[model samples]
Target chain A: MSADFATCYPLKRGRAHEVCGPGATYFAATCCNFSDKPVLWVCPSWQQEMLNPEGFAAYCDPARLLLARAASQIDLLAVSEEALRSGTVGLVVTEIFEPLSLTHGRRLQLAAEAGRTTGLILMPEGMGSNATETRWRCTPLAAGGDSTLQCWELIKNKSGTFTDWVTRWDAAARRIIVVSKTGERPRVARTAG
Target chain B: MRARPVDAPFALTAKESNTDRIQCLNTRAERAGLSRGMTLSDARALRPDLITRPADTPGDAGFLRVLARWAGRYCPWVGLEDADGLVLDVTGSTHLFGGETGLIADMRVRLMRAGLETRIGLGDSRGAAWALAHFGEGVAPPQQPLQALAELPVAALRLDPKLGIGLERLGLRSIADLTATPRAPLARRFGNGLLLRLDQALGTQPEPVVPLADPPQYGVRLTLPDPIGLLEDVTAGTARLLAQLCDKLKTRNQGARVLQLTLRRVDQGSQQVELRLARPMNDPVSILPLFERGLSGVEAGYGIDQLRLSATRVEDLAPTQIASAIRQSQTEDVAALITRIGTRIGLENVQRMLPADSHIPERSFILAAAAFSEAAPNWPPRRARPLRLFPPEPVAGAGPVPPVRFRWRRMALRVAAQSGPERLAPEWWLEDENWRRGLRDYWRVETAQGRRLWMFHTPQQPGWYVQGEFA
Candidate 1:
């Protein structure tokens, strides 16, 4: 990637980015790293108890994270929309068990735009269809020593071509480092024409 | 006062138990030489176009309470004088309508228009005011309460009727006659109440009026001409009340934190729904929807005759800054969002993190209620901590040294890499059961299976346990 696109991942303000797989939370946390403002975490009430504040401190300040627990999936979506519309929050991350409909995604996008905030939806793997600007599937790889490796497949992008990248999440340093330019699978050789 | 027939003379009667009597007589009925408190049969003999109605004592009391609340517009301090009267403390408020005389006149006219007969009194003391309103000549506030009260009848002191008759038998037909007698004898004869009443009316003794609490600060009430039972009607009423309530809040520069909607049914029973906000707000548009959800639970059985919206909790609302358009919009949006979500879920469940003062990993941060607390502006610089921590789970591995392999949660994990043992001692000043192991040596271990686990070894117990995991 060139320097121009190095810092930016096509994640624009007022847009929704869908991250799926076991490493979704980690990827969403990394996306949240773009802004220094407060972030809203909207999830199910049961999920809230399992959330470890120490983990989020890696990407965003713990004090900057506000937790909103919803009793149901509908409430979760509503809370995310509300938080996105609230211009005060820089980022809104929602955990949904089911894929959001196109209308709901569009509404979230509009609200995010109006508030000048970003929204990240964390959903289960393979639940692909969404209105988000970009969708990435992340899978946690075996650790190489102390650092955890993750492979992200950019399955859909509204502004760019499909690509893949291998990255290392350094827990101690609390930073994400691109590990390789090639995709996770070995590159196929071709004869020169 | 006479409860006369509307058009013609009628033999009317009021029944209390078995003793039926002519409680009130009309002009023509009285002209037939009939008097009040006469037996119903005697009134029947006079002329028989008889009609009677039972006196509604509870209805009268309810009307009196309504009147008292209505009087709050005139003065914030209003008290019920009796079942039939309302007392308003218009000390400073009278000037708003011009003066005491003007205020009284205005109130009289308004009450008359509302189909109520009213008499107002003003005095330096409550006792003096009560005496003047009930017994003295209908005059302006007296310059000298004692002199003005001296000419009134003895009953004007608000004495028991039997006591008044006894005083009259003793030649004390008027207050002047009672005042002329020696104080000691008067007290001994009529009991101490007479002198106390006299002193209180004369302004020598204190007679403080316990004014009713000011009407709900952000409340607006609407009494319908006809009862409504439909949900839409209730919502419409709520919207109307919210607009009025918001206007009141705007004037006072305050916002409601909790609101209560009372629906008074025609059956004389009332149902109330309370809505709590995550943030204080005065905007009616945002407030109405919250009431909409709460309205579902309110039973509008029969039909609702009155709807009252009251802000039970209020806080001073500071003006929003317009310096930075973007910042202002964001702040307002966030606040509004918080309020809306809070109403739907609950305010207590919304939480924000605050940095706590402690070196212990678990004690380093605490979750505080978002509505009551503010985010800690300066959190301590980040240190290496696991992404997730669970209650210490025992690991089937032993040693002061790193274990080559371990079994946790039915999974076998071979340690591929390991970090140092960061020693942390128990906080001596505090008693924690989890920390009873005295001291712990923590290690960051990366397993071959890609899981990074935080394991701790308590030297005293000689066992290793997985305490947290890094995402």
Candidate 2:
């Protein structure tokens, strides 16, 4: 209900311009406050074998985040691939390592629209933007005091709005809080991690 | 004493004043043209020939009481009317034994074997039973007392002479004539006594016979032609009784959940073994082993004459299909196996975990016998959990993070990769003893040994512990 509750938003570059894209894309950010509508995030790599620290951390972070948000009727039924295909989850956040079929993307798009759930995809850095609501590229941000940091991003939002926005990250808290509200020149801060 | 053939003529002759004219036996023989209370020699001198025998009062009474008990087989409820009489209220049950005639015929045959002469009365009242036993000449007449007792004079009632004369003078020659008189006049003149005889004969006055107390709620009874001695023999005997009990369950369309096996040893002091089943079952094969296990080492002092197996707690058990096709068939069959194991280990030793409708892992279950437990419903919605869960291990830590180094099961490991601070707060309503340790931060940590395990560190206790390992 308040400004601090808006925890995270799409990362910005130079100006807080809108995002546009050609191919189907996904954008996701964490909620800062409680609402009746529960927040859902999905990762296709949830079942992936954790070969390294980064990969293992990737699996562990979402689980912990979901557990933290278990306060608001946590429904974990969507972890199954079948559940993802059915769009049973309110929000989907899948890491795209390989190319997905167009049919898969269309089904996901229709399901997300029908179920009123946001679809978020983590894509590789090389692929240029295609038809999508929003597209974002993020790298680790500079740290702030007390486990807080910020991220740089390149986005393709179809709305042609808020393309270049900074992503603030709190690593110790596993939280990403947003600073900019309006589409304007973005100011950034750096801190030692 | 030598036993007499049951069909032989047995007289129930009692002394009568009018019988003085005829020489027979006992006091009547002496009184008839003989000396008063004279010796048999004197009685023989008067008649030249007189029959004589000692009175068999106790023998007859004892035999009659036995017959009364046997009569109980006809109806669940039966009572002894008097010294030489039995009162059977075959009101609704006459048809069950194939009407009064067949029942009387059956009783006659059984009695003949026991050496008794009987006069059966099919009546609606005790008064009618007495009247028929003493006065009725035929086997069974109509149930109507007036028509059945009409030919018999008023003296047939066994009343005193003055009372008979009064009834005769009142033109009440038979019970029918007496009942025909107005109740008001009879009460005024003959008093309630005459009316009582009338009402009792016609089946209305509450002439309730004291019925024997109901047979024990459940009886374990046995019948064996050859008595048994060895423990194995006793088990076989018990098996037979268990079969009989299952037959009874089938007839009732029910099954017994709890059973009592009684061993009536020839040496006296009976032994009782109680076997409990997880669920009510009527099949003899399933129940026999339960008792047999108890009987395997039974010490029959001398021998057991009979065996009795009775169902204590019975319930309806319908047939069901065995599910050998299910994925969990192996686990399901383990229940019957456990019950067999219970035979050696004692039934109480067998225990199973039943899931309770709760989210908390430890509190979500109760222990019961697998045999008796109801099948559990599908698992609740939650993250993929290990089939096995250990008691919460105390971990050393304060803030939520995967420990860089932690010791578990006496082994210290450096976290090769760390995953979570999945904070799990204890449910406030549930009183968890470890709640004092505060919230838990669980992490899936992969060790250098390539064994991926789930571990948690308690923020309150300031320690790290391994909870489970991923396969």
Candidate 3:
């Protein structure tokens, strides 16, 4: 794949990606917003209440979004795999708490490849490792002005070098803006009034 | 059939408090001077060795249902007529078996082989069939139901036995005796129900048989020569039945929405597993895995002798266009996958989002069943809202303008930037407990910690509450 294709974040066709940490779900939604195709969102039943269409409507067409609430982690995985393999859907997104094993990840990758669809797995903060092509840890940062800032750290990248970036999502323009890069330094926690 | 000499006297009895009463007696027992409704104690006293077994009402009812299902082979419409009899409407099917006599003979032989003694009755109406089954010795001509039923006893009309006795005592022993009697006086003397039954049987009144369910349009059955207990055998049988069922569905241009698989055990018991699909489907490959999941829970105890696959719910299946290979595979794969997961976790859990007609954030959109409801139409432009919203949580800070700082979830957050004071009034016509706070102004506040919180000020209560978060 070209560097431009790899650089475009969220998820890509015929590949499996994982977004972890506190703002994983937000990042997953942002990824869905970028896709032109319809999205299949599978989540635990408890998390169903958090799916705000108003937030999604900023980037994604609400009419094109489909939701599947799974009763358990196992069902979540199964439904995600099924949705991924279903070529009718352009993107498959799942919120999971359990760690995805290598074999399971590989299976999802193969299904996505066969269907020519994208699979995005959203995991809670501090989940175990998996064999995904790339794993991004996303955390929401305090907003400075009109745009919302999110810290994305590529913790695992099989196809390239690991990297991190501070990006701001411009809700009005419906695009991401790259902020100034910091060289391997911890972020300063500031309070505003 | 030759009548054999009496070897042993036997009767089926039901326990009534402290005594057992004979429900029914065989020919040998009746010949040995026993009668139905006779106390078992009295019958035993009359004959020292009068054999008896407790009545199995539930077993008999279950067997009746089984027979009803079996009768489906002869005709699409079969209903239970009383406890021991079944009514079959073989209107168009009779010709397939060479006529009514042939069908009756075939049923008799099969039922006898199943160890069940049966009596059949064919008529133009349900009441006629019922009367003929119990009274008439041979098949009655369709044109002359009244003539065929005339000589039979008044009990053939299915009147209460007490009422039958009342008519008999009045010199109305046979149906012919009542045919000539005046209707009003006979009804007045014997109650209106007697006349109703007589009219229904004589075809003057309409009596329709409400079948258990509409006959399945597509079904396939497999009877093994020898019972097989292995799971493989069950799956293999299901595959075969599904193939046959799919072929039948294809001919009708229909697809099955719900499938039922019945595994009849060798012990006269059966196990039924039902699969509900997320979408209508006719392909056997896609249907096989769903049955596999259900078959794991089924106990094929003592081996299964028969496997029957039936499409319980069928709908029209539009012919598929010759699409690209990828598109076709994708459609098939998704449908199959949905069916598999839906069968495991239930189809209701699979949902799709649809826009509602309300402006309230909570009521703006609804989750609908994916299998039934369609996606919402073009959604109206939405204002900026939080990615994640929670039940309104109270904030300690209060102010007419945007709060400079606030404490929520025990976290002290300073407002770095404030955006809106968009005034919104509560919907007056609706009774919403959450909106009881009256008019409010919502502001988008960006905190120093990099969290964008959606906080609102309820002017009525003059309190600040954090409602949602912007990603």
**Top-scoring candidate (lDDT):** 3
Question: What C-alpha root-mean-square deviation, in Å, does candidate 1 show against the real structure?
Answer: 17.6
> RMSDs, each prediction?
17.6, 24.8, 14.6
Candidate ranking (TM-score, best to worst):
3, 1, 2
What TM-score, to 2 decimals, does candidate 3 have? 0.62
Model 2 over residues B103-150: C-alpha lDDT tens digits? 888888887776555677666666766777777844335567667776
B-chain TM-scores per prediction: 0.54, 0.50, 0.54
Better of 2 and 3 by lDDT: 3
For model 1, residues B124-241, the per-residue Cα lDDT tens digits are: 7777777778776344345577666777888888889899999989888877787788999888887899899988777779876677765445678999999998889899989998
lDDT of model 2 at residue B63?
71
Q: Rate residue B230 of model 1 by lDDT.
A: 89
Q: Estimate, for each residue in A6-55, the C-alpha lDDT of model 3 and write its tens digit.
A: 47574556888888875776787777765565688888887634678877
Model 2 stretches with alpha carbons more than 4 Å out: A1-193, B1-217, B223-227, B319-335, B346-353, B395-398
Q: Enumerate residue pairs that collide in model 1.
A: A87-B330, A88-B330, A143-B450
**C-alpha positional error of residue A191 in candidate 2 after TM-score superposition, expressed in Å:** 50
B28 Cα displacement, candidate 1 (Å): 69
Looking at model 3 chain B, report the run of 10 residues with the lowest lDDT sum. B1-10
Ranking under lDDT, best-scoring first? 3, 1, 2
Interface RMSD of each: 2.4, 17.9, 2.3
Model 1, docking class: acceptable
